[model samples]
Target: MIDDFLDGSLPAVEEAVRKAAAAEIMPRWRQLATHEIVEKSGPHDLVTVADRLAEAHLTVSLTALLPGSVVVGEESVHADPAVYAALRGDAPVWIVDPVDGTRQFVRGEPGFCTLVALAVRGEVLASWTFAPALDEMAVAVRGRGARLNGTAIRAGSPARGAVLKVAMSHPDYTTPEEKAALLCLDTEGVEARPCGSAGLEYLAVARGALDAVAFSWEYAWDHAAGLLLVEEAGGAHATLAGVPFRVTGANVLPFTAARDQATATRIRTLLTAP
Candidate 1:
């Protein structure tokens, strides 16, 4: 089936994406100026030349690798929603955020990365997050276990009354689901903070930097790779609806152990309506 595409092509894809991202990003990362930073909103929504360059490189390379596919990109959408609507529905698609942590990148922080995903029809088939700055790559296929920098990973066992450490955002723009996530953190007595960037938030949970992650909503490029990484890292990652991770927003994702599954599930119940 398509497994070969992942087995044979994944390693190659990870390397190419990493090189492309680094080439377009690292040089401009705080060390030098690529372009003037522009704020999308309140100075947190940021854009830079590196983001554009990295996405451009990814789009070109992805076109070569899978000419039969179309690309759905973050910048394209930001530039114009029309670009998103114009994507070819006739073929598979690559969902990409050339640089997921734009604010982090602009701020010269290490939390930002390149997020890429391949989806057929409406289901995510494969995904990757290349954190070039950290020399780490997280990759995942539909059924294959997720891998971080090529190492096998799994979810940890659950715990009880866990002091869940979580990542959050200001409740202002957050959907009802996001608010519930923050509530769960407070209810569970876990420390929580707005870690910034969907990619970074998920990475922290996968690496044990945080115990769980609850978000209002996330797009495919934002959560696809990270979802796989968390699951592969031996952690429970599911939306409030308890669905396998999807790009849908207004959803809460909780990473917990077996012991906390019940608690996590209870909290997730509160997020179901949205």
Candidate 2:
């Protein structure tokens, strides 16, 4: 069924996956738990019941849809060293973060999302990021471009010497590059809202809300789906080194195509120049 669906031989199977994702997710969106959330990285890093449930739901349904495809979810494998081992094996893997913005979720913010991405041979093949709160899902394939809800999406603006909107992680834990980018880039427009997720930032850039986002940490499940969205949405993204995003384990400095990659290239060059 997986092969058939990938080969464009079964639309029903694809629809089944989509429906399963939504059905298994919506009801539990804002539901609370009786217990406190777990702290993965630190006090700011959060894990909730909704995260585990959504991931588990996706895993179970996708497993039935595509038998033999490996599944690595955020709630489970993040702490399991065995996951690293299994992921290094010779198999297609689905890297999912059922809830990408758990911090925001806990804060009753609707910017949280479900990230579903398929990586084959360590390369991202297809991605679907569902922002339940915004009723937006950015779906992208390698060659098919990207879309939100059923309409096509694209990125076509830049922020320079103007009002700029930027998103970042917690400043208390922000990386050096992220801080530098904020300081060095001067703009009249300041809509700097640092939420708990990179997925929403990427989607905003794709949909033309934010102008750029500089990540202080490495890329995770949150940004992979966003990377595809930005790339397919006609935006430009690269590491701090100015390298076009590939499978490298590097953090990203995402800028709009409206900047025509010049700003990104300049920033990357500035960051990497030593």
Candidate 3:
């Protein structure tokens, strides 16, 4: 069923993503009231009405699109962590981060997006990243190439001898050990900055505008869509153990996704250096 849908119903999924953003997100952009936004873990971690409503909207619409499918949404997991177990269940799972950059969204910045990935068991089969305010939608299917607004895209290898530009997880979000691993990117020939939105940073890597991304956290909703996009665009990703990242957790921290395998290996090496 999933294979047949991936072959022909991809656009249906795309439309579902776009509809969520249009109906629930864009309307609240820069117009949020004080009561509409609230903190989850801390001030830096926020959840707005837009996020909750959008995820709810997607949950209903997506499950309706693919009967028997389940959703592992950020807001839903926050409400009930047990909902996250769906990722490992037999049912097809929709991993969703309804608002990827809630902090940016609350601040009226246009750097946020909606991320959705279709995963069966542990493998991501298709994904969508929709940045409504920016008017960009990126789609990726397992065996097919990636696309941005209907045009094929690729993550071309970075130039030799050129400095590697990397977006890394912010220090506040990392443990001391993970922070130490990410700090390895500070060496010569690599420019590292705090990441904005995990999805957009992955999109940057996929489109070749950014060299790579080294993220300490491993939330499937945050990395699932982008990782698939990067992979379909001819890029590669690796955890500290130098293996492909797993959506089901227990991954070596501070994973790197790069334009190509060599870059991913180099980043992994740096992350593991003493």
TM-score of structure candidate 3: 0.99
TM-score for candidate 1: 0.83
Of the candidates shown, which would achieve the greatest lDDT relative to the real structure? 3
Q: lDDT of each structure?
A: 0.66, 0.65, 0.95
Clashing pairs in 2: 163-189, 164-189
lDDT tens digits, residues 94-130, model 3?
A: 9999999998999899999999999999999999999
**Best TM-score among the predictions, by candidate number:** 3
Question: Across residues 156-251, which tens digit of lDDT does each residue of candidate 2 receive?
Answer: 666456565666554557656555664554333445556557777788778877666666554447666777777777777666555665442543
Worst 10 residues of 1 by lDDT: 251-260
- What is the descending lDDT order? 3, 1, 2
Clashes of 2: 2
Model 1 Cα lDDT, one tens digit per residue, 103-130: 7777788878888888765567788877
- Superior by TM-score: candidate 1 or candidate 3: 3
Q: Against the hidden true structure, what lDDT does model 2 obtain?
A: 0.65
Q: Give candidates' CA RMSD values in order.
A: 3.5, 3.5, 0.7
> Which model is ahead, 1 or 2, in terms of lDDT?
1
